[model samples]
Target: MTQGHHLRGIMLASVACMLWGISGVAASSLFAMNPDVSPLWLTQVRMIIAGIILLIMAQGVGAQPLQLWQNKYTATRIVSYALLGMVPVQLCYFEAVKYGNAPVATIIQFLGPFIISLYYLVFKRTKPTRSEAIGMVVAFVGTLLIVTHGHLNSLAISPAVLIWGLLSAVGVATNTLIPRPLLTKFGSLSVTGWGLLVAGVCLNVVKPLWQVHLTLDWAQISMLGIIIIFGTVIPFQMFAHSLGYILPTEASLLDAFEPLAATVFSVLFLSVQLTGFDLFGGALIIFAVMILSLDAQTLAVLLHRRHSRNTD
Candidate 1:
């Protein structure tokens, strides 16, 4: 890619991450306002709506959204991607936001790259270098500070929230790694549109949106609308498309921006009180991301394509 195009990709990914961070705060606020609303219900609603828009967008771009479904194997793969990837990613993150604050959830979700590294180490026999090892340790320590407040005996956040956030990180890893072929073949818009729509349909089978009646006022409706359109669809599209222009290493580094944006938004709008440890810990996590990004071994690992190196 040219310099200008590379910069555009970085900017797109950064803006997407920030929007996601702000969306985390919005989700936290929504859960607080509607105590009766389940995260599953919200996930279903957002995914379905966003999926429809994306499918329409895919068609608009002549990406052929429906082509994947015409073939049985591709259809099965997309469905698997939907259930295994998008569902956990969307539902777990929202559950984390619902149970804990946005800043904590977003920062905790940053553990995704470590999860990806471990996957390579265990399954693919890709041993991490010293820097990658150090980076993982740094990230773990930072997470410990935030969750435990530097006290081992007690957790600053609930165990349930922590579990959900960790699960979300796993979801992030799978979501990033599993859809590569789909992305290359059908394009990001098509793949995400189908994945999200299928996920929403399956979740709806479980939760059944019509079964739960929510009496949302205008403000709540507005926030929900913004979450569906700007947060869910737009950012997802931007980050996915940016992968075409820039290396995933640069994109992963920019992922740290999500937690920063979340922290700022939560403090300003949600009046979240962050301890000194929280700030220090969050910084450490971001630092680890940079370390992994800059480290040659880590960059080599990041550049390793899933099945075929030539595809990348």
Candidate 2:
């Protein structure tokens, strides 16, 4: 792609990450306002509503979403993607926020990018260069500072919240990686639409939405719309589509924006306090992202792609 297109893809991914950050704050607010709203139940609603809207949009763009069900193998993979990646990611994030707070949950989930890198190293035998290794260490230290706040003996939250937060990170990593081939094959919109639909249906079976009664005022209803549309649908579509243009590692690095957005929104809206250590930790994390962003190999790839496109 041209440099202009590359920049546009980065912008899209950045905006998507910011939206997800806002989503974390919004979901946390919903849980606080409506104590009766179960996380899984809310997730079910988000998946179904966003799924339908996204599927409709995909069709509007002339994408054949029905192709997802053309074969048993494809159908099964889509279902598994929903079950293993999308559903868990959303539910675990909401659960973490419901149990603890946004900043902690978001910071923990930020570990997903690094986890993706490590997974490649361990399983795929992709060795990290010196800069990437340093970046990983910086990210780990940043996470330690954010969670422990310079103390190791005590954590900032309960054990359950920590567990849920870690699960959210895993889900994020899985969500980013698993749908890649599907995105390449079916396009981003179709894969996301069908994945969300499958996840919604299965989650609804587990926790029927009809069983829960949510009394939403205008504000709550509006928040739900934002959650479903801007947060879930728009961001998912943007991130997925950007994956077609950018590397997965670049996508993960862009996700560094999410926690920063979450922290700002949480402090502003949820009245969460931001300490000096918090700022320091966040800077380290961003710096790690920059390390990868400025990597020689990554830059070479970008130049190569841009050159190839120009010649073509």
Candidate 3:
């Protein structure tokens, strides 16, 4: 790929992570504003509304949003991606946030990248570039610092909450791995639009929308709206599109930015306290991305023993 395309992919993925972070803050606001809000119902609404709007937009953009269903194979993949990938990701992350808190949820959810990396290593028989290996390590340390506020043992863990968090991570991996062919063949907008729509429709079978009701005030409405547009629709499109331009692992590593965005938003809008650890952690995350982006392959080969081993 050209350098310009790589830059574009990096930019899209980074921006998507930022918006997702902001959405995390927004979703947290919904929980605080009204404890009665159902996680299931909230997820259903976000997916359905965002999905419907995206389909319309996809059609307007001539993406042939309905064409995937014309072939049985593509149609089956669509359904699998929706039910197994999108549905679990959207719902599990919400449940994690609802129970364990966003910071805990985010760190756990990032396990997706590791899963992706390992998949490539074992199943695909590909080694990570030296810079990528280093970046993953840096990102993990940075994430831990940010989420734990430099206190690793400070987190309060519940069994169910932990399970939900882990599932969110698996969902992330599933979402990233399952849709590559479809995204390459179809493009991000239509796949994501249809994926969300299918997930919403399928979920409705078990948790019918009419079965749940809750109080909705303007604050709740605004938050929900933010989650739908900024959180659900826009970021997924950018993330999916970025995959066409960059490796899935690169996109996953850049996801470290999400926690940083969430931390900043929480401090600025939610009156949460920010500490030096947060700043240092955020800086490390950025530094990790910089490390991953460097084009100095020869230097990496000289510095990383694994490269020499592979060469041997």
Provide backbone clash counts, one per model.
0, 0, 0
Ten residues in sequence with the least summed lDDT for candidate 3: 295-304
Give the per-residue Cα lDDT of candidate 1 at 82: 92
lDDT of 3 by residue, 143-241 (tens): 667667767787435656668877887798778666656765677788888888889888888779988778899988999999999997889888878
Candidate with best lDDT = 1
lDDT of each candidate versus the true structure: 0.86, 0.81, 0.76
Ranking by lDDT: 1, 2, 3
Q: After superposition, how far is residue 183 of candidate 1 from its true place, in Å?
A: 0.6
Question: Model 1, range 95-129, lDDT digits (tens) per residue?
Answer: 99988889988888888878878988898788887
Model 2 lDDT per residue over 1-312, tens place: 888888888998999999999998988888888788778988999998898988999899899899889977668778878998998788998899899887778877777756666776787576777887998899889878877889999875677777898898889777866665566578878888888888989987776888877789888887787889889988987887786678766876787789889989898888988788878987887788668656736434533554455335
TM-score of candidate 2 on Cα atoms, chains taken together: 0.87
- What is candidate 1's CA lDDT for residue 50? 93
